[model samples]
Structures are given as C-alpha cells and as structure tokens.
Target: MTQIDRTMSLVRRAVDERISQAIAERRDEWSDAGPAAAELLDAAADLLGGGKRMRAVLAAIALSATADSARREDVLSGRACAGLGAALELYQASALIHDDVIDGALTRRGLPAAHRRFATAHRGSHWLGDAEAHGRSAAILLGDLLLSAAGSELGAALAQCPQGTRAAGRAAFDAMAEEVALGQYLDVRTESLPLPDEGADHAAAGRAMEEAALAVVRRKSARYSVMHPLLIGALLGGLPPHGEGARRLAELGEATGIAFQLRDDELGVFGDPARTGKPAGDDLREGKRTVLLALAWQRCDAGGRAILRRVLANTRADPAEIAAAAAIIEECGARAAHEERIDEHAERARRALEALITAEAGLSRSATADLASVISLLTDRSA
Candidate 1:
C-alpha cells in the first residue's frame, strides 16, 4: 500500500480501538445502571464507527512533519499520536450525534441515525409518549455525553504532552467545538430567515444568499472538520515554524476545508444514494439553505428563482419538485458555478499546503506530497 493509505489504515485502527475502549470503559463504569447505559454506549460506538476517519487522518498527517522516516511508525504508535487520533475521532462522534438531531436525518454511514434509531426502538417496543420526542430527548442527552467524553479524551491525550502544546491543542479543540455549535445555530437560523432583498437585482440578492450559506460552511465544516484538527495535531506534534509560509497554515487549512464542504454541498443535492448513504436530494427534503441553492438564486431567471425559493427549503417538497429543483440548479448553472468554486479553493489549499510544509523544519518531500494528495479525496469522493 501507499504510504498515505498505510498511515490512514493505522490511524483508522487507532481511532476504532480508542473509541471502542472508551465506550467499553463507560459500559463497565455504568454496569450497575442497566440497559440505558448500554443503549447510550452502543449509540456512541455506532456513530464513531461510521466516519471516514478523516479528522484523525488529518491529525496524523500533521504529526508526520515532525517525524523522521524510522520514527514515523514510532510516532503513529506512540502514546501521543494514539491519544490525539482517538480524541479527534471521539469528538467527531459527538458532533455527528448532534448533527443528526439537527438535520433530522434518518441515516448516518448507511445506518439509522442516532435519533431515528432511538425513535425506532421506542416505536417497536410500544412504550412511551411521542416516540420522536422521546428519541430527540435521548439523543440530546447522548450527544451531550459524547461531547463530555471527547473533552475528557482530549485532556487525557494532553496529559503526556508539553504544557504549551497541551494548551494550544486544547484551545483549538475548544474553539472548534464552540464554533460548530454556533455555526449550527446559524444554519438553523438561515433556514428560518427570509431571503435577502436586492430591489430589482436578482444577482445581488443571490450574492447575499451565497454569503450567508458560506458563513455556515466556514464555521460548520471548514473550521470544525479540517482546520481545527490540523491546528490541534500540529501543535501537539510540536513542529516549529520556519519559513515564509509558517504563519499561513490556518488560512490554508480553512480554505482547504471550505472546498471540502462545498463539495459536500453538491453531494447533498445531486449525490447517488447508494454511494452517499442518504436518500438522493436529502438536502432538498430537509430544506437546507446551502451555497448550491444560493447560487441558483443568484444566477437563475425569475421562474427559476421562484422555483428555488418556493421549494428549496420546504421539507415537504415532493420528489418531482426535488428533481425539478436539481434540474433547475444544473440548468441555471449553479452546479457548474459551485464546482468552479470548489476548484478555486482546492487550488488555494494546494498552495497553502506547500507553504505550510516549506515553513516547517524536517518535513520530507514525500510528507509534503502525501498531505497534498488528500485534497482530492476531501473534495471529490462520492461517499
């Protein structure tokens, strides 16, 4: 296997094992509490099992810059890397638990979503008041539990690292957690708010809409998924900065993450269900006000704009309407436009990657190359 694949495999193993161990310990701790603990632990484990392990992989990639060839494997297996990798994955599990609740999504990683799983149980067991309400309440608490566990995991990981490094890593993790929560609020808010007005200028209003959606992307995806993990890992890895590009990693990471999120926006609207693991046009069904929809408003005609504004976020919009919305997006050139933006940000990330690597000492060319290679996977993958 390629070095990238190998590193990812190892990190993936570390994430799984770490998360499993954490849940098992919790299970043991709550052994006297009965099946409720079992349900919560099982849900957390299931969510943790579903991700691409990309966040953990990003952490490992940052660590690679500080390790020599022989020590790379050592570093991966070290207490530090294992701790960081596991911590990052566990944190993601917490986020997904809440995200599913917010999005009202029925599935995650091809399985029933956390909230839905609970609701299904409530219905199947034929017990309780409203199944959905009970499910939502359980999910809220479960998400909170995972969030707390993630913080504990981070604290544990930091215990063995230098004080300065620990502080930096913790700062990134805490900042990201806060941003994601607020970002989710902004997303929910955007969906509830009316479209921006631009008098007779459909184009200007479209730009306004796009800006709002991009705001959600910046907080919810770019910072949360990619940038913060890079910061936390690099800080924990303790690689000193050295070149002109030394200070730009944050900007680079953010740009790279935005591109990744924009691709996700596209997939939400036009993705294949079998590959994406959610229903096709699930975004439309949920009425998510993404950049894709914003761009459609900006560029399309009045009929197209009305079509989007009318049906894009209805949640009750039908399949024919969803299909019509998708067609309008492609026809009005939003799909192409959104794709162009993804390419633009990806190119920006490439430049930033080179700069960040060049800014650091002892970063191998292959290490630089490996980090660069992940951009495509982030932006172009089907699932």
Candidate 2:
C-alpha cells in the first residue's frame, strides 16, 4: 500500500476500535434503558462502521508534522493520538447523521441512512404511530449521542496532552462544533431564500447566490472539515495553536476544504451513483444552492432558467427533466467554471503548504508531502 493508504488503514482501525469500545460501554451503562436503547447503539455502530476516515487521517498527518522527531514515533503510536483521531471521526459522524436527516437523504455510504434505518426497523417491528417520525426523532438523538461521545473522547485525548496545550485543543474542538451548527443553519436558511427569476439583474442575483452558497461552504464545510482538525492535531503535537504555523495550516485547510466542498457539489448533481453512493441529481431534488447552480444561473438564458427552476427542488421531477437540467448546466459552462474554481482553491492550498515547508513553518518534509497527496485526492475524485 502507499504511505497514505497505510496511514488511512491504521487510522481506520483506531477509529473502529475506539467506536466499538465506546458503544459497548454505553450499551452496558444504558442496559436499564431497554431494547430501544440497544437499537440506538446498533444504529450508531452501523453508521460508524465505514468511511474514508479523511478527518482522522488529516489529524494524524498534522500530528506527525508538528511533533518533535524524538517524540514523534511515540506520539503516533500512543493512545493520545489515536484517541484524537477517533474523536474527530465521531464528530464527523455526528455531522453526517444530522445532515442526512436535514437533506432527507435515504442512503449513506451505500446503506440506509440513520433515519431510514430506524424507520425500517420500526416498521419491521410493527411499532406504534408514525414510523417515519419515530425514525427522525431517534436519529436526532443518535446524532446528539455521538456528539456527546465525541466530547468525551476528546476529553480523554486531551488528558494525555501537556497541561499547557490542553485548553487550546479543547477550544479548537468547541469552535469547530459551534461553527458547523451555525453553518448548517445558514445552509437551511439559504435554501428558503427564493432564487431570482430571469427578469432579475443577472449579475446581482448571481453574485448574491454565490455569496450565500460560499458562506455556507466556508463555515459549514471549510473550517469545520479541514482547518480545525489540523489545528487540533497540531496543538496535540505541542505546537502553539495560535502561532504562525497554525495560521499557515489554517490557510491551507480553508482553501483545501473549499475545493473539497465545491467538488462535492459538482458530484452531487452529475456524478454516477455507483461511484458517489448517491443518486444522480439528488442535490437538485434537495434544492441545494451550490456555487455550481449559482454559476449556471448566471449563464443560463430564460428557457434554461425555467428548466432549472422546474427541477431544482422538485423531488418528484422526472428523470428526463433532471437530465435536462444537468445538460443545461454543462452546456452553459457552469460545470467547467466550477471545475476551474476548484482548481484555483486547490492550487492556492498547495502554494500555502509549499510556503509553509519552505519557510520551515514546522512541518516535516514527509508529513508535508503526505498532506499534499491527501489534498489532491480530496479535491480530485469520482466520489
């Protein structure tokens, strides 16, 4: 396996081990709560069973980059780093579970989403009124449970860190959690904001849409997905969290994270189900106000705009209409523009990392290379 692959495997194992142990403890502690509680833990296990472990891998990479050479191997192999990686994974799981509920997504990672799974179980067991409602309610609590677990795990991880650095780590974690919640709220509110019609000034409307979408990306995905993880890992590695190195890593993370989300937006509408594990045109059905859609609005004629409006949020839109909307996006050069934008963000991230390494911003050479490789993989992918 490649170095990155090996690192991912190790981190995945650590994440799985941590999750299993935590869930088992919870299951035992809550046995008095009855079968309903047992089922909740089962759902958590299922949802946490598999993933790319991107956030965990990033945390490991940053720890390697910042930790002193004499202590590096020990730190990487010790419980502290493993716990931190696991904590990040659990946090990511919390976000995803809640997001799927928000999006009404039926599946995640090729399996029923948390809410859907609960609903299916409820129906199978012939439970009481409103299986779907029960599912949504349970899934929300499941997400919250995972969030609590994440905090507990982070606390365990921090206890292993030096006294001076623990507060920084905790602060970073809290900031990430708060930012993502606010970002998600912005995303929901943006979806409610009406899209401008063809008669609206194209430039102004396009700019407003793009700005709104990018705001969601910045807070909801960018810093939450990349920057905070990097900072937390760096803090664990004994680097001062607010130092020049942290600043540089934040720059790299924000740019890389934005590119990652933009690519995800592109894939959401046009990517193959087999590869992306999501139905084609799902984003259109969900009416996500992505930058790609914003750009398409800018370039589309009235006829094309009408077609988009017809299918943009219409979950019942026929497959043919969805295909036409995708076609219009491609024809009007929105897809191409979106790709160019992703490239710009990715290149900026690469440059920031290069500068960090060249100026001895504290990252080791190998760790920097690994971070670069991961950034490329994240931004340029089929899924």
Tens digits of per-residue lDDT, candidate 1, 1-383, equal 98788878877887678778888899999999998999888888777877788888887777666677877876665666677878877777777778889888888878998889999999999996999998998998998898788878888888867776777678778898889989989999988887654356778777887898899999988978888877777777775433354356676778889999998889888888888888778887777888888888878887776677667567777788888889999998899999999999999988887776656545666567667778778977777
- Per-candidate TM-score against the hidden true structure: 0.95, 0.96
Residue 351: error of model 1 in Å? 0.9
Question: Positional deviation of 256 in candidate 2, in angstroms?
Answer: 0.3
**RMSD (Å) per prediction:** 1.9, 1.5
lDDT of each: 0.80, 0.86
Q: Which residue pairs of candidate 2 clash?
A: none
Q: Where does candidate 2 stray beyond 4 Å?
A: 68-74
True lDDT of residue 242, candidate 2: 62
Candidate 2 C-alpha lDDT tens digits along 144-247: 98998998999998888788888888898899999999999999899888889667898679878999999999999988888888888887777776677777
Worst 10 residues of 2 by lDDT: 68-77
The best candidate by TM-score is: 2
